[model samples]
Target: MANDFDTIKKNANSFIIEIHKFIRENFQVSIGDQKKYLDSVTKDSVKTGQAKLGSFIISVSDVLLDSMIIIVYTFLFLIYKEHFKLFLAKLIKKENHPALMDILSQIKVSINNYIVSLIIEMIVVAVLTSLGLWIIGIKYFILLGLITGILNLIPYIGITIAGIITVLASLTGSGEISVILGILIVNIIVQFIDNNLLVPLIINSKVEINAFVSIMGIIVGGAAAGISGMFLAIPLLAILKIIFDRIESLEPWGYLMGNHVPRKFAWRVRRTKTQE
Candidate 1:
């Protein structure tokens, strides 16, 4: 853990150094003879360089604080969990208690299934990606694959970012354009398999929402709260869908949000003569 932290810290500092150098190197040639503009950009660049160490310190502090808060909250939630269920039950009338229980149960099962599927999918993707890249002779394949797999959790956007990064890594490692193209092709194939086979079998089975709606939710979440929001949008939508489906007036909303398809229509399954 300590070694990993040191590696990350070294990489972070190197990244900042490279950014500063790039800015300093390019600003003179890229811009015209606008003295005021150049001066402002230079000042900002200097400020950024100066703040690099401070920013790293702040990030570490934030991680520690967040971990501490999560530990405290987890302990509290575990201790008072029954109380929470009681509080939820009391929110509705006694006559509606059973329906409320069913709704909450649905939410619990769906979310738990979704979370488990995600962890499993991420592990598979990471392992496969790393092994594939290694076989293809890419440097630092393990690190790249791990990054790609984690990013892949963010849905559509993650794969795009991973593709770009993989291509860049390939180009840098091999200095051959062929390597870049190979990486892109490999990534595309992997993603196709993930989308059609793994994801449908795992995640989509649990949280069946409309693709267009899911994309829009991710966009809205990204706009509202950045990466974390985008990462959480689908699962949150699934939970909301369960609640919406249970409430009489909100059933229409849930229906609109879902895939509205039968499970037999799975991509991998062929239409038999009887079905046809």
Candidate 2:
């Protein structure tokens, strides 16, 4: 038990160190010249990015949540086999049992297709993240690459929240307090990289919505679809905003839903100073 604990702790420390390096690298991406680069990325690129990011996050979160639900319900299936088995049994009893086989075959094909799509999306994320980590000179670049790519699939605050959760989990399992500190420091640095650099360039450039709208979408989505909704809502809204932006009649609505390219810097500065 002691050895296992020690091993977990060591792994946790390594994980934290890697995470920090990833963050530092992510932040190094150019957010574009405040004056010019914004004009370069098209509205379509923003819409596509938003959709891709949203779909990835929602799908990952859904799978995780579904796994949790399955675990919770597993014991019930065992104890209440008669009640649970009835559904499958009834299907088996159908006159055209061959149809059942066809249905099962279709289900299998669908599952395989879905899994393949997920793998492809994950690959894209990993490549993008790994490139960033490599540039940042983070160790265990592959691991950070996978994590950031997967985590980004979650909408708005999902990636940030996931990083925090991962750091906290690592800290709790770590044997040395230094491991915890290491993880926290690394995450902060990574987030700085993401927020100040990578995200501003990738996410903000694509989704032209303001902070307030994003927050509001998260709240409403969370209420409706729970966490899954929150993750999906932002991208969905961004798509709507994009279409709205193109039409004169709907431009005002889009403006309300979307964000201004350059928010009031002075107001943000004052708000930050006040918080400080």
Candidate 1 collision pairs: none
True lDDT of residue 59, candidate 2: 67
Q: Pick the candidate with the highest lDDT.
A: 1
Q: 1-276 in candidate 1: lDDT tens per residue? A: 233455444554555455455566787433234445668888879878779968867755654454455457658977997898899888879999898889878878887888898998898888878888887888779998998888787656567778767765654444444465567777877788787777767776678877678778889977775555666677889989999999999999999898876567854355564477
Per-residue alpha-carbon lDDT of candidate 2 for residues 118-216, written as tens digits (9 for 90 to 100)? 455456656655665455444455775577657665554555654554444443344344544654455556556655655444554456556678677
Weakest 10 consecutive residues, lDDT, candidate 2? 29-38
TM-scores, all models, native as reference: 0.61, 0.42
List runs of model 1 lying over 4 Å from the truth: 1-83, 155-173, 195-197, 262-272
Query: What are the lDDT figures for the candidates, one per model?
Result: 0.74, 0.58
